[model samples]
Target: MKKLLLFLLTCLLAIHLAFPQPPAIRYQVAEPRLADSLDISHYAKKRGLRAGAMVFGLNMGVWTFDRFILKGDYAYINMHTIKENIKHGFVWDNDAFETNMFMHPYHGNLYYNSARSNGYNYWQSGLFALGGSLMWEVFMENEHPSANDVIATPIGGMALGEVTYRVSDLILDDRKGGWSRFGLEFAAFVVSPMRGLTRIINGDAWKRRSTSGKQFGVPNVSVDISMGIRTLELKDEILDQGMGIATEIKVAYGDRFDTEETKPYDYFSINANLNFQASQPVLGQLNIIGRLSARNLVDKPKHYLSLGLYQHFDYYDSDTISVSSAKTPYKFCTPASFGGGFIYQYKGLKNWDINAFAHLNAILLGGSLSDYYKVDKRIYNLASGYSTKMGADFIFKKEVFAISARYDVYHMFTWKGYSGEIDWRKIEPKTLNAQGDRSRAILHAVGLRADIRLRNRLYLTGTFMNYTRNTKYRYFSDVFSNSSEGRLMLTYKF
Candidate 1:
C-alpha cells in the first residue's frame, strides 16, 4: 500500500508538466532566475514567517496522528525524552529501509513545499527541510536522532519537492473558472498538499484572472505511458518468472540540447517502471536526472552537442524470491548523486534522428541488499561510491520506428561492518550501531528497446535487459548473481 502511494506521488510530479498550452520555447537566456518581464500576479508575495509556521504545523499534525491514532512507541515523547535525544546526539537507526529511505524524504517534501509555494527559491527552501528534520529528530520522537535520516531527508526532499512544486505551478491556472478551475486546483492540490493549502489560505484557489499562472516559461514536454507484460529470470539455471503486468511512465521536461538554464532541474527527465505480480518489485525502478548547468558545444542545422552537470536520483526494489534453492532479495539504489555528462544529437537524411549521452557521477549515498547484515528487519548495506552510464536512441520517420540502447555500471564500497572474528551467536542484536557487512559491490546492466508506431501518438514497444551483481566481502566468500528481464508494451504519448 505504501509503495503504491509513493508511485502515485511520483506520477503526480510530472502530470502537470505535460500541460499543453504554451508553445515550446528554448531556454536561450542563460540566467536561472525567471525574467522580470514574466507575470508575477499569480504568485503570492514572499512570506517567510508564514512558511516557517506552516512547516512546524505540518510536523505537529503528523506527530498528533502518530501519537494518538497509531500510538506507536516512538511517538511517546516528552520533555525528558527531548533531553535524552539531545544528549544521545546522532546514531545509526535500525528502522525499516523503506521508512528511512522513502518516508522521511516524503515528509521533508512537505517542509520544502511549504516554503517554495510561499515564494521561496530552491536553495532558500532547502533550509526549511533541514530545520524541520532537525526539529523532528530532537523533539517529536523519544528515540535518539538518526544519522541516516538527517542526511537523506533534507537532500532527498529538496530534489523531490522541487519537481512536485514545479508541476503544481504549471497546473494552476488563475484564468479559468467553474468546474474547470476547480479540477485544476484539485489536481494541483493532490500534487502538493502544502502548496494547495497555502493557495486556499491566501484566497488564490478561487480568484480568477486573465493572466496565466505559469511562473517559468513553458519548455517542450513529452509524457509517455506504457502498459504490458514483463518476465524475469533470477538465475541462469532457475526457471523464469511467468509473465505479469508492467507499466511505465516517462517524462522529459525540456529541450536539453537547447536549454541554457543554469538552474537545477530546469531541463530534466524522469522514468518510472511499475510491475504487478510479475515476480518483480511492485515499484521496480524510478530514475530521475535533472540538469544543473549546461553549455552548448555545437549547434548546427544537422548536428548538436552539449555538456552539462546533473543531479541524479535512482531507486530499485524487489521482494525476496525463493525458487527451489535460491532465496535472495534484489535491491540497489542511489538516492543522491551528482555528475557531469555530454549529449549529442544528429539529424540526418530520410527523417532520421539520433541522440546519445554518457555520464559519470559520484554517489553520495547508495544501498544494496546485504547477505550478512540483518538488524531489526534491515538487510541493506549503505555505502558511497560512483557510477557510469551511457545510452543512445535512434528515431526514424519522426518516431514511426525507434530503438534505444543503454548501459549502466555502479561500484559501491561499504564503510561500516563487523570484524570477522565476532561470532554471530555472541553478537548482541540491535546493540551495534549499523555494523553492516564490510564489502564492495559492482553492479551493471545493459538494455535494448524497440518501438513501432501503430498510429499517431501510439506505439508497440519491446525491451530486454540483463543485470549482474558481484560483491566481495572481507569475512565471507564473494557473492555473484545475475538476472534477465524482458517486456512488451503498448504506449501512448502526450
Candidate 2:
C-alpha cells in the first residue's frame, strides 16, 4: 500500500516538472524598458544553453567521484540495477531519512544554482533541478533509484536554493575592490559555492553592478546573539542543565500582503540557528519558507491567503543523565522534512496583526538514537505528520515597542519503526518484537517575545520558549519530557 502511494507521487511530480504552468507575466511594467536597454531574446537563449551545460558537467563530476573515490558496488553503474528499477518502478528505500531527505536536497540545490545564476526564473529553475535529479538517479549509481529522493530533491532544493541565492546576494558587493571585493566574494561563496563558481566562470565576480537586478521589495536581515541557561527534566527528575551560547540569523524578503502578481518566493523567510554547548556544540538547524502563490480576499484588502512550501533541516545530539543510576545515555537525531501548507494573515485591526498556518509533511527518511530505559538503541523511522502554528502581535507607539506570542504543535506517526522498550532484557525473542513497535508522538512549543526599540535598526529583545514532547507506544509506558529556555539579546537589522 505504501509502495503504491509512493509510485503515484513520483508520477505526479514527473508530470509537474515536464509540463509546468505557463510563466506568469512578471515585471510587465518594466518589460519595455528592459527590452530597449538589453537584447532579451538573445540573452535568454544563451543563458539556457549555459545552464544545461553546467548541469551536465555537474552530473559527470559526481559520477566520477562515485565510481573512483567511493568504489562501493552500489555507486557503480550497473545495467541490471537500472533495468530492475525501470521494471519495478518507484519504491521506498532502505537508506536513512537524513541522507534521502536532507543530503539529496542539498545536492539538488547546487543543480538549482546552475539555472538561477544563468537568468532563469524560480519556476524554470525548479524544472532544471528536477531534470538534474532525474539524470543522476538514472545514470549515477548501481543501486535502484528511489522515488522519495526524486520527490524531495527538486522541491526541497528550490526552497533552500532560493534562500541561499538571496543570502549570497546580501554578502556580495561588486562595486568594491582589493581586499574588500575578495573578502565579499569569498563570503558569498561560503553561502552559495555553486553560484559563486558560476560568477567566477562568467567573469562577473568583480563586476561593478549586481547581476540579478533589483528585488521586488526591500529586504530585511537581522542577527541575534545570545547567551543563556537551559534546563531539561524527564519524569519530574532533572536530567541535564547547562549554559549555552546561541545565534540566529533571519532574512525576510518582500511583504506577503503586497498587491501585485506574486512570483515564487516573492515573500520568503529563511532562518539559521546554531547552539554552542558542552554535549553538542554543533547543534544546527536551517528553516526556509517560500510563498508559491497568494491572493487577497474579496472585499477585504487586509486579509490574504497564501500557499507556500517549507524545508527544514535539524541535527540534534545531547547527553541524558539518569537521576538514580547516574548513567549517561547519548541521544542523537538527524531529521529533515519538506512540505507545503496554507497561510492566512490578517492586518485589518489597528496596531494588531495575526497570522496562522497549517502544514502536512512526510518524514521521507531519518535516523535517531533512543534511550527509553537507559539502553541505547539505534533506530530508523519513516512517518507522516502535520503541524500548525498561530501567532499574534501588538504594536504600540508607532513601531517603537512590540509584543508577540506564538504557539505551535506537531504530531507524527511512526508506523514502521519500533519504540524503545522499558526493559530490553525481558523482551521476547520474536523477530518483529526485537525490531520495536509502532508509536506516535506530539511536540508542543510556545514562545513569547518582546522588542524595545533602542535606536534605528537596533533593538533590545527578550524571548522565552517552553517545549514539551510526549510519546506513546502500543506496548510501553508513555514518556513525557519538557524544557524551558530564556534569553535576552540585542538585535541589529539591515
CA deviation > 4 Å runs, candidate 1: 1-38, 41-44, 234-241, 278-280, 348-350, 423-430
| Residue-by-residue lDDT tens digits, candidate 1, 70-185 | 99898999899999989878877776666766677778888999999898888888899999999998999988888778777887787778888877866778889999999999
Most TM-score-accurate candidate: 1
RMSD in angstroms between candidate 1 and the native structure over all alpha carbons: 7.1
lDDT of 2: 0.56
Best by lDDT: 1
What's model 2's lDDT at 307? 60
Superposition error at 302 for model 2 (Å)? 8.1
| Pairs of residues at least 3 apart in sequence or in different chains that clash in candidate 2 | 97-365, 97-366, 418-436, 418-437
Q: lDDT tens string, model 2, 200-229? A: 988767766523332322243333333332
Global lDDT of each candidate: 0.75, 0.56
